[model samples]
Structures are given as C-alpha cells and as structure tokens.
Target: MSDSNSILFFVLGCIATLALIALIFKHRFFRQQKYLPKRVITPFERKMFLRLKEAFPQYHVLAQVAFSALITSEDYKIRQRFNRKVTDFVLLNASLDVIAIIELDDPSHIGKEQEDAQRDAMLHEAGYRVYRFTQIPTLAQLRKTISG
Candidate 1:
C-alpha cells in the first residue's frame, strides 16, 4: 500500500478502536440504578406492624426503621454500637414523637437474646418504652399494654 493510504488506514483503525472502547464503557457503566422488591420486614413483622396501627389508629407506624435516627447517645461507643441497628417497629403519636418501640422476638432472635436485652436496656436508658412480643399480639392485649 502507498504511504499516504497506509497512514489513512492506521488513523481509521484508531478511531474504530476508540469507538469500540466507548461503546463497551457505555454498556458496562451507564446502567440506571434502581431498587428491587425487597421486604423491609418479614411476613410476621408485617402482620404485627398492621396490628399495631389498628390498635393505635392515631399513631404513625414505622417498620424496620434505623435506630440511629430514633435515638442517640452522647457516648461514642454507644453511638457506634447502635448506629446501624434497626427496630422492628416504632409507633409515633400525632405529634410525631415516638410513643413506643415494638420488637418481634422471632426465631432469629432466639440465640441473640443478650443483644436484644442490651437493645431493650439501651432504649430504656434513652427513656423510651420498649415492648417485646413473641408472637403477634391480640388487639386487646396490645391496647392493654399501651394503656397500662
């Protein structure tokens, strides 16, 4: 091939390679991020959340909410320890103040009793009422607990 034609072919090849690189990057990196269908709480927890809302119609029900937002501590260790923790359900009165924290003691919590106790204690120290239920509570039982 002539020198000019050889140089022209080399330039075309470089352009094609760059276009291929750009296409590959677009395919690999430009995908839109999105949320998938993931359950925030278990089926049992869902039932309990609904029941609590029914029991206290005026209260706002929050399920699987972060503990760090609900309560804080002055101590760094305490803050770090519970920063990433989550509560099963939190009930907020009309004023949006936390009225109570309801934790479902499911099978997964069996071996983690110590952690649960510590969590309950932490909430208590924070001046919040924490209620534990092995199974979903009856409307009457829940009302009685809330009232008394």
Candidate 2:
C-alpha cells in the first residue's frame, strides 16, 4: 500500500478506538445512574416539619431547602457561598418572606457545632431568626415559640 494510504488507515483506526472508549465510558456512567427517593430529610426532620406546620398554620414550611433560594444578593461571590448550604427547615410568611429557620441537631451534628454556628450566623446576619433544636420538639413547644 502507498504510505499515504497506510497513514490514512492508521488515523481512522485511532479515531475509531477513541470513539469506542468514549462510548464504553458513557455506557458505564449511564449504568451507574441511581434512582433515589424524592425526600432527602431524616426521619426526625419529618416530625419537626409537621409540628412546624401545626404551629404556624398560615406559614409555608419547607424542608431541606437551600439558603440561596430564600436569600439573594447582587454580589456573585456572596451569593455563591449561600448556594452551597441547605437548611433543615425554613418557615416563610404569607408574602414569602422568611419568618424563621429551624435546624435539627442530631447526634451526627455533635462534632460540627462550629460549622453550624457559622451557617446560623450568616442567616442571622441576613435578618432571619434561627432556632436550633437538639432534640425533637412537640407541637405545643413549637407553638409556644411562635406566640412568645
């Protein structure tokens, strides 16, 4: 075969091999796709959510919501920091303003108190009241906070 023809075949073979590798990786990635349930909250969170709704019936209760969704800033750098964190629950008033934030502190969060404080401080700076409950609260207890 002519040198040119041989070179052409080699180029085509290299391209085909690369394409095959790409396809295999793509197939493996697709196979790894997992189907997760919609709810991301722990069992304790669900209980608190119900109580929060009962306490503030007129308010909107949100679970596992991102901080960026409630607060917005024109500064990109400032906004990006909030985008990375999610609150356990957020209580919004009728006009969609954040009335308060509830953070559940289970055993898993014991070692992360500093991290939690930073997040709570940021929320507080944004003029939102934050309530951190170490144990599960009752409907009466939650209601008392609203009235007090």
User: TM-score of every model?
Assistant: 0.81, 0.71
TM-score of 1: 0.81
Q: Per-prediction count of colliding residue pairs? A: 0, 0
Worst 10 residues of 1 by lDDT: 31-40
Please write out the lDDT profile of model 2 over residues 19-128, one tens digit for every residue: 99999999987676587667688788888887888888999999988888767789999888788899999888899988888898989998899999889888888888
Root-mean-square deviation (CA) per prediction: 2.7, 5.7
Best by TM-score: 1
**Position 22, candidate 1: lDDT:** 97
Off by over 4 Å in 1: 1-19, 28-37
Q: What is the C-alpha lDDT of each candidate?
A: 0.90, 0.86
Clashes of 2: 0
Model 1 residue 13 CA deviation in Å: 1.1
Candidate 2 Cα errors over 4 Å, as ranges: 1-35
Give the deviation of candidate 2 from the true structure as CA RMSD.
5.7
